[model samples]
Target chain A: MFPKMDALGMAGAVPRAPQQERSRVTRARLLEATVECLVEQGWSGTTTTLVATRAGVSRGAQLHHYPTKAALVMAAVAHLADRRATEIRAEAQALPTGPDRLDRVVDMLAAAFTGPLFVAALEVWVAARTDAELRGALVPLEARVGREMHRLTAELLGADERRPGVREAVQATLDLLRGLGVANLLTDDSARRATLLAAWKQQLKGIVNS
Target chain B: MFPKMDALGMAGAVPRAPQQERSRVTRARLLEATVECLVEQGWSGTTTTLVATRAGVSRGAQLHHYPTKAALVMAAVAHLADRRATEIRAEAQALPTGPDRLDRVVDMLAAAFTGPLFVAALEVWVAARTDAELRGALVPLEARVGREMHRLTAELLGADERRPGVREAVQATLDLLRGLGVANLLTDDSARRATLLAAWKQQLKGIVNS
Candidate 1:
């Protein structure tokens, strides 16, 4: 059993080390479950109770950490995106550099967008379109994530933003890859996407190298 | 008052000309209203009763034509996309067909995706990711619309798909424009998007022209 909160009814009051570690594991599970629920059930179908059950944490514990569904979902969004950024960097480390570096980096970024995390993020993006409260939470988080991705892409390609068109070329690459991700959602658009990526990689070389 | 359906409970049973015209107008109103509702309320918040009220049609009439929510929404998705394609073609007619044709075409496509129709389609797309029935209705319709757009884009750019990379170049252009549309949904991404489009236009000219 988890330890009780202090008189202030706050979990942030320096709980014992063992309890703190347990709490971290529980929260991570909750966030991961929230993402899975979003991917499986979408924004409307996902609820706090359902997420709690899926996460294997008690409803009370879920509420204690994130009182509202918005808080829980937003936290998951942030967590998922942060994890994805780290994953992209880690994956990039294994890639080879040289003539094929740009192609490999583009493929890695495209793969990042085609997975479950992107699907979860997309559900939030569509839901945020109509919900102002959710939109408010999502906007800043996405901006930060997007900036990090753009910076990472520029670094990976070794392209200098100061060299005219380099910044836009990098951005175009992200946008094109994301669009391919969207296209892949309903159907297996892999064949068309492969062709497009090959073409983009070639044009990307000229822009970044020249 | 509107005419009643035939004994077969079908409106396509050779109704009177005036009644048929009225039905056409009513159907158009309903489809337009559905798109608006999807954009304003999202997929979960959109309902048959709400769409009927918004369209100024009786719920009975709405059901008589499209018995299920999925049917109504799918029709709207197809209708919205069709209208957008038509608008794009009509708008493109006024665009000059000279040196700046490719830039103008790219700009036009980007504008198409940033509008309410695209937002409504996006709402359905996310909803369809988890809803099998909705996905079933959407895939073919989107493919048809996508093909039309691609063909029109190729013609407008005077790009020959017979060329090795021209097809992928055009597809990439669409994907990039669409990704820009997604980026615009949550924030004002015009400045960054403008720069990216400029860079793409230049690269596109080489791929498509060569």
Candidate 2:
């Protein structure tokens, strides 16, 4: 009886029937292609044609998924951010709360920023600055990341946003992380990365203790 | 004798060949134009042609001065860095050694990173990552900034580079400053800047005391 022709069975039987699955595949392809193009040609050099060619899709098909380059870039940035957030969150959760939390955060941040996906996303951000439309799309993502940092810091420091030095610590930490991101992109020095991470841990410990 | 050779015969004398003052006017004009274009069109948008147009100079004139877009951007970065180094040095010299030195260093670093010129230079740096040629040219400038930072931190802490945590502190502080530069660019929140600066100072103090 062919497994009772239900939506699940039919969907499984016909691989191309489900719109959601097809959409997911298209989105994945688009993101993978975006990253590839970004790493190969950088943000300024990556074009729709290049992404389409890399993705093995028609330009029209690519457009159907991401109507504009800005849109595609934004999607890529979000994709990267989402993955990083998950990774950081997991690391933060695994660490014991006090000083260890700070270490975990710094290590996680350094690793995340230097990771290939994040590097590609950062390229998009650089590209987005020259693009007003893309910048507009990126603002919310920036805010979201900031908010996450604020939340994480608040949790780690046992202070609210209104606490005397909580805001400063959070901001400084974020800045440190951002600078390290740039450093990683510029230099391939693991020792430098380790030194930076250690310093961040030490600094965060000071902030927490003080 | 014809009234002493027409009153000392000084009438036709070329006015002491006016010491051809090496005017930095052209350089200043280029830097100003670069900033304007960067702010208007971003790093990628500020091409040599666009910068020349903005500076009201011919392409030949621009090339004669800068030669390459990377050269122009790097010149702007160096100009900004020089100004910052001068400002920090002045502030550091004004302070009596002890804790005041550290305070002034932190203050200067915070202020410098958050300033407009630094922000513009950062935008150029983001663009530099994509252009290997520009990145190569700019790395030394970045290293110089880092070296200056390490020197300042060492002096402030009265510690050598080989000191237990001096290198880490220096690296971390620089990373913090870099992150702050990006944060300031992304948002127009003065309050956040002040908070971040205070936190940075406190953190530095803790490290020194520790």
Best model per DockQ: 1
Query: Over the stretch B10-116, how does candidate 2's per-residue lDDT look in tens digits?
Result: 22433343332122556667877887787767776778998888877778878988998778888877876665666666667777776666766776777777776
Considering only N, C-alpha and C atoms within 3 Å, which residue pairs clash in candidate 2?
A175-B179
lDDT of 1 by residue, A56-159 (tens): 99999999998888899889988877777767777788888889988988888888889888888888888887889999998988888889889989998889
TM-score of each model, in listed order: 0.91, 0.79
Candidate 1 residue-wise lDDT, B1-210, digit = tens: 677754223335554689776787788878888988988888888999999999999998898887888888889888777767767777788998787988998888888888888888888888888899889989988899899889988988889999898998888888987888899998888888887788788888988876
Regions more than 4 Å wrong, model 2: A1-17, A90-105, A149-171, A203-210, B1-23, B56-58, B91-101, B153-163
Model 2: per-residue Cα lDDT over A1-210, one tens digit each: 445543222223444558877776777788778987787677778898889888888888899999888888778767656656665666577778755666776676667666777678667665565677777778888788668766765565554557566566666766676777777676675788786667666655655566
Give each model's whole-structure lDDT.
Answer: 0.85, 0.69
First chain TM-score, candidate 2: 0.77
Q: Can you give the lDDT of residue A36 in candidate 2?
A: 76
The TM-score of chain B in candidate 1 is 0.90
